[model samples]
Target: MRPTAAAFRPLTHRITTGAAITHVHNSSVPQARGILTLKDHVYFAKATARGRGRSGAVKSNGDCPLELKMATPKIIGGTGDGHNPEQLFGMGYASCFLGSLQLMASRMDKKHVAEDAKVHPNVFLGHPDDPTLEGFGLRVEITVEGCEDDDVITAAHEYCAYSRMLKHGANVRVTKA
Candidate 1:
């Protein structure tokens, strides 16, 4: 049985890393609520260093805010209409795969000979009738220059976590083709 609101004390948990930084979250309150109270300097710094949103994500106060979409970049096509969520999904998946590969390489202490690695990730959306989001496929082709066969293979195997997150048995079929 779940605890009643009257019984809830709004427990707080703090995560501190060796006098460097501290993060606190209340499980009962919404994540957005009291978020401003946190001294999120380190979090902001990390995001900024990674070239992520610096100002911070703005919240929508409206009941139904206007749906704004970014024009798709010229490289992917679609008249630079960023409105297509599919294009965004494709880009996200491709970038995620490459990131995972790089992370794996770093963990293995394998140095990349080339500065940049190429990863082509293809994302296919299922028919609208398939509300389960089934049959959504992703194909990633990686071409890393100056990397030996052993390191490349190890990276590939280590990066399988991305595919593992897909809905179980929803056909996240991967092929080297």
Candidate 2:
């Protein structure tokens, strides 16, 4: 049987590492329910960044020494020493969207939709000269491969968290390839 929220006790489990700690709250309250299994539910990733705007570096709180250097392309007069924010965003979104796609496919009994699937998220940064407009904007094109039908891909896209988050706020297009 599936474990409901009422079956669990209301407690917060704190996992700490070095200077970072993440609190996982297990609630029995019926109203505060989450769409996840009992054991594996909440997930978190923490990272800190320092330096100038496009020339900064970020490191995760994990034991492994994971660091990233931020830089813009030389076309924009940047040194292009490392990846920029747009690339990182694309990577994160694509990976997350692929997970969502796989989950949705499994749930819908369409396992082949996600088998050996690949997601390509193309993120573009644009700056308008209009003073009234914001500093910059992003346009994303998410292309999915190994999916048989566009309808299935669209359904998965609709269920993706990144797609939901950027649906109304950003200009995003999803295509099946």
Candidate 3:
């Protein structure tokens, strides 16, 4: 019988705005506002083979296909402007820091293998020789391939909630937006 705090604050703001309204922004007006609007009707098909009409097909709403492309994506922040939101918050903090370093390498059994985790973060929008972001920095390059050396020096002294809120700092409590 414990349900105060505005009844769980609308389920934690619907799981953080439902993971940011089901993120789908690869451009083109936010990808046609999350697909299905070229006047609908399956978005044109049935006219191929020497007919010149089938060079576009990454649009769906039922089987998960609203434009998403990321082959080995690890660009967290901007290196040359490929996208923003700090590269989606550095790819969600480099996949939650490699799933918490593979759950601490399976409860200390070792053989760690988070083969690929990157966060080339940078948001110094007004520094780095007059960038502009004002302040933001990240340079976490974790590629611990086949693990060893005491599980990569014991997950490099673990404890990484986004690197402890970027080390020793966190008190976000805004009210009345």
Candidate 4:
């Protein structure tokens, strides 16, 4: 026997306010709150890192454990075993920016723009000359390939989440190659 719509209705009532509800057929609930909520959707990602800076390791809690060996260069007085944080950030940003390009392309009805697009995110860590300021800062250069028209590329960059997030914080530049 299959469950009826009424059977599932009660289960949704227990959901807390502001929490994402996976399924809600009754439109009145959202209207009453005067708020828009993501329906039938939830996204989550988790990871844990250990050890010293640059020379540490990280693991994700997904079905497949993603173990990463992190290390620094000999110039920094450390063994360059695997990869550094900047490289990892660049890799992740590149992939995410590519997805952002696809998203913008679809929204703008220019899906062809992203068909063969490639994103190269270059992450650089540098120290400030000012002695008062401690630690280092990052500079990013994102190179896009397989697409022309600088205006369209700029539009896509404006729509990219990574670009938006880092724009105010880092020296981020997007260019065509």
RMSD of each: 18.9, 16.8, 21.8, 18.4
* Candidate 2 structure quality by residue, lDDT tens digits, 63-98: 575789888788788999998888888898889878
lDDT of each: 0.37, 0.61, 0.34, 0.59
The sequence of per-residue lDDT tens digits that candidate 3 reaches over residues 1-177 is: 100010111122211111121222311121111211123344422211221122222222444334332221234332332233334455656566556666676666653444443323232212222265454333333333334443432343244455444432344445672
What lDDT does candidate 4 reach at residue 105? 79
Writing each residue's lDDT as its tens digit, candidate 1 over 1-177 gives 111111100112232121111244432342211111323334211111111222112222344433334444455443554344445445555566566656776676764632265555444433333266553334232333334444443444334433323311122235572
TM-score-best of 1 and 2: 2
The residue-level lDDT of candidate 4 at 8 comes to: 15
Instruction: For candidate 4, write residues 1-177 as lDDT tens digits.
Output: 110111111133322121222334442242222222334546556777789877889888867778888888666678987778788877887888788777777777888877898888667677755577787766666677776645456566655555555432233355674
The C-alpha stretches of model 2 lying farther than 4 A from their native spots are: 1-41, 63-65, 128-131, 168-177
lDDT of 4 at 120: 80
How far out, in Å, is residue 51 in model 2? 1.0
- As a whole number from 0 to 100, the lDDT of residue 13 in candidate 3 is 23
Per-model TM values vs. the true structure: 0.37, 0.66, 0.22, 0.66
Q: Comparing candidate 1 with candidate 4, which one achieves the higher lDDT?
A: 4
* Winner of 1 and 4 under TM-score: 4
lDDT order of candidates, best first? 2, 4, 1, 3
